[model samples]
Target: MKSLLKALKRCAVAGAAALAVVSLQPVSSAQAAPAPVVGGTRAAQGEFPFMVRLSMGCGGALYTQQIVLTAAHCVGRTGANTSITATAGVVDLQSSSRIQVRSTYVYRAPGYNGDGKDWALIKLAQPINLPTLKIATTTQYNTGTFTVAGWGAASEGGSQQRYLLKATVPFVSDATCRSYSGYGGLIANEEICAGYTAGGVDTCQGDSGGPMFRRDSANQWIQVGIVSWGIGCARPNAPGVYTEVSTFASAIASAAAGL
Candidate 1:
């Protein structure tokens, strides 16, 4: 499938036939993915302090003051990497008040080979004062309306956005998502899907690794999914797939503790 990650970085145009072949492919790298959030609205300043923009064109959320949670496909093998920068605390990419932090190390999912297990963690050189996002440990917050935000493409095969964009999408059941053409065998039980059956709203390319969250009873944000892949940006019958955070909650906590 056209990865929602391609919305992160611009790539050479592929032939229509090639695009069709990739429609069934999982996101193996950050270079491939669909366009940005279609039919999304611009986010205001300080709206999402935990949101992070990776230098490789992906998105992430602050799991702690010094660690970030993102898609495994958006990063490389586990190791130290000073080159990967994380930009946060702003809605506009060009904002002067943005806080930039360099990654001290990266920990890609242990068995992430594309078919599920798409989460990763990046250790920053220092901690930031931004509030970290709470991750769901149960399926309680997995259903209903989810808010997805990113700097990915705004339309299918379009350019990335400079300002953060966001949109709300209703959750689609695993059975329903699998019933769609081209997705029958792709949706894993450890993954969550969300979007409209008629399309027009989703997390695209650059949105990879970003949080798909919902408000809890306390009216606080809690992350449920990590943007992973999709056939195309906001396409009909094809919803955006994400790594079910609850499935890896304990593992993520263990990883973060080490970081």
Candidate 2:
């Protein structure tokens, strides 16, 4: 498979990811500037209360008092592991208001290998009494504005952020995503793309497993995707790819029931 991102090894996967992140950073010697989503800004406290940080190096969202939604690649070598914990209900990770919950169950799609089915549901040992974000139930045009947040790196090859950062990324068609270099035939229905062709705002490492949300007609936030992979962090022609949440909503409902 084509490599997943920039520091790819730079901002890509590590830990339990069977595939170690491969650096896609252009061999350059200059220091990289700080960026959000790719060009985003710091979010205010409680702005994204649903955002959660996985202790193992990925991002996630609070699905319920006892469940968190994240990426399959983030739950250690297997979802069955019990060492995972999620810090929730805070913008700054170091905040005193944060509630930590150990994962009791981690469920990845039965067919998950690496590429397509990238989502996972984490059952917490206790509930975090906060408002939760809902999942989208149908497919829609991925061509408008969307929001993504994480404690991931602010830029490619940069260190993971200490505070939560957010950015508004425009959705790209599957064709647009596929047209990018290294992504020709890899775009799948279970995935969605969002970003700019100019290399500004985009998700980075540590941002993986975070939520890709949009405001619905009623002006309520609903999760449409889960941060999964990309070719680079906020690079021109490289957009962030996420697990299309709607495609797996049924599966999530079914699997989460067993929790």
Candidate 3:
């Protein structure tokens, strides 16, 4: 049964592209990156107020009272939309204290063909009272250990969780990440990699568009990356890749202002 589950996990992670096309539409040609917590713990109710579970099996963070930051591949182009919903204020999906807001508009990164840029902003129909998450503008906070949270699968090829799960992954240098077999010259400046090379903790399926963040000098949580893609769920030498939030910080700010 254990071996069978592992096989299922690999199949699920490998078929991410097809899954994206069928349910998440307009995904990039590159491998789709969305996974749940593998080797993570359940988060407390108020641990991450800015964190939200996307109705479309992805994760996101509140950039403003009415704006959310996520992976571009997780949404459609810039336009009016009322279908996407953001659920926040609680870790447990079954909790009655949860706050729900629908998306009003989506602004995917310009020229986001899945080659490089993978970040997006979503304007909400109404503002939520939750504390918004701050994004990193410089590379200062791009290093070290980062926290990733989502309702994605608790194991590779596993089912999505009812409660938010979180795990910490160390930042893997671009040079080291690029050294991987399948990642040669593919790790762009707009992307960042994080995970254990030994293969343990990571973001698995259902965790797409989630925040990869850490506390700043001011002891405040600031987002540095967005869960984008990877080779597999949690395999050695195959770390989870994320959209380097700092690389497109300026553009994101401008877009958010316009939204």
lDDT by residue (1-259, candidate 1, tens digit) is 4343333322212100001101112222232223323737787788878998888878889999899999988888999888889989988888899899999999998988766788999999999899999999998887866888888777766666788887877677777778877666554658887776666666665777888888887999999988877777777777787889999999999999987
lDDT of 3 by residue, 1-259 (tens): 2223222232222111111101112112233333433637778779989998788777889999899998877788889988999899998888998899999999999998765688888899999999999999999887866888888776666777888877776677777777875666454678877766665667777787888888889999999888777765777777777888999999999999998
Q: What would the TM-scores of all predictions be?
A: 0.86, 0.86, 0.85
Model 1 misplacement above 4 A: 1-39
C-alpha lDDT values of all predictions: 0.75, 0.71, 0.74
In model 2, the runs with Cα more than 4 Å from the true position are 3-39, 77-79
The Cα RMSD of model 2 versus the native structure comes to 6.5
Return the lDDT, model 1, position 238. 75
Say which prediction, candidate 2 or candidate 3, comes out ahead on lDDT: 3
- In model 3, the Cα lDDT at residue 177 comes to 78
Q: Give the TM-score of candidate 3.
A: 0.85
